[model samples]
Target: MTLKELLGIFERQGIKRIDPMGQKFDHNLHQAVAQIETPDAAAGTVVQVLQAGYTIHDRLLRPAMVGVAAGVMQQVNTSA
Candidate 1:
């Protein structure tokens, strides 16, 4: 059987994949691996998924390893 077939079988068994791309960062569902500063997306949004996560029924089997978008930091002059 192919990988797709295996995945289909798992889905039928109530194992589902968590898609985190473009979604808001949720500690319950995602594990932030890095904070990426980008203007393309809002801060706290999931910018990249390093590893796909799964869930069995309503229980989370693993959190999706992801990179969260961070707002560009503005340099504040401390010396006056």
Candidate 2:
């Protein structure tokens, strides 16, 4: 699911969604997980949580999807 969809889940659950990356949530996710150690990662699963202590206690909509060292998985080509 898309990041927006995840946020929707939180909204439905009466929870507040926090976007660390601000308006650029996707870009923020990429920046947050970059250069982090994620051993035994899957093909499209590299968004490893570095630390959770910093997170405020609240209902999470869902974890963000992050690309590996390369980049995110784009379903459609943006070069049009």
Candidate 3:
């Protein structure tokens, strides 16, 4: 699905979309959908959201809403 379609999910879910390039969720969403690796259920949800036609941005400048596996640690040091 195109990025425009992905942002629609956020609008439906009432979640705000942020433009964080290289972000995990963004990256995962793109990778999963692009590679057809995302779970069936999740992919279905994405399709549903897109079909709903609810987009985050008003006109342009919107990103994708990704559903990635949780618990993955960020690169930031947490052992301080």
Candidate 4:
């Protein structure tokens, strides 16, 4: 069977894809490999997914390897 067909079979068996591309970075679901500077999207947004994650039912089978937009984690105005 083709890879697509195999994936379909897995999906039918309750395998779900965790494609969090363009979604907000979640520490619980995603593993941020790098924080890149990108103005194309909001900071902390998932810019790229190195590896797709998977799940079965409500259990997390794997965390997605991703790169998130870079920005100040906590911007503080020192000038008063």
lDDT of 4 at 5: 94
Q: Per-residue CA lDDT of candidate 4, range 21-76, in tens?
A: 99999988899999988768899899999999888886788999999998755668
- Local distance difference test, candidate 2: 0.42
In the range 1-80, model 3's lDDT, one tens digit per residue, is: 88777667656766554442333443333333232233333322332212111223353233354333333233787896
Global fold similarity of model 2 (TM-score): 0.24
Q: Which stretches of candidate 2 lie over 4 Å from their true place?
A: 19-80
Root-mean-square deviation per candidate: 1.9, 13.4, 13.7, 4.0
TM-score of 4: 0.82
Backbone clashes in candidate 1 total 0
TM-score for candidate 3, please give it.
Answer: 0.22
Off by over 4 Å in 3: 19-80
Question: lDDT: which is higher, 1 or 3?
Answer: 1
Best by TM-score: 1
Global lDDT of model 4: 0.89
Which residue pairs in model 2 clash with each other? none
Off by over 4 Å in 1: 76-80
- Per-residue lDDT of 71 in model 4: 76
Residues 1-80, candidate 1: write the lDDT tens digits. Answer: 99899899999999999999999999999999999999899999999999999999979999999999999888899997
Query: Residue 51's C-alpha lDDT in candidate 3?
Result: 14
lDDT at residue 17 of model 1 (Cα atoms): 94
TM-scores for all candidates: the values are 0.89, 0.24, 0.22, 0.82
lDDT of 2 at 48: 45
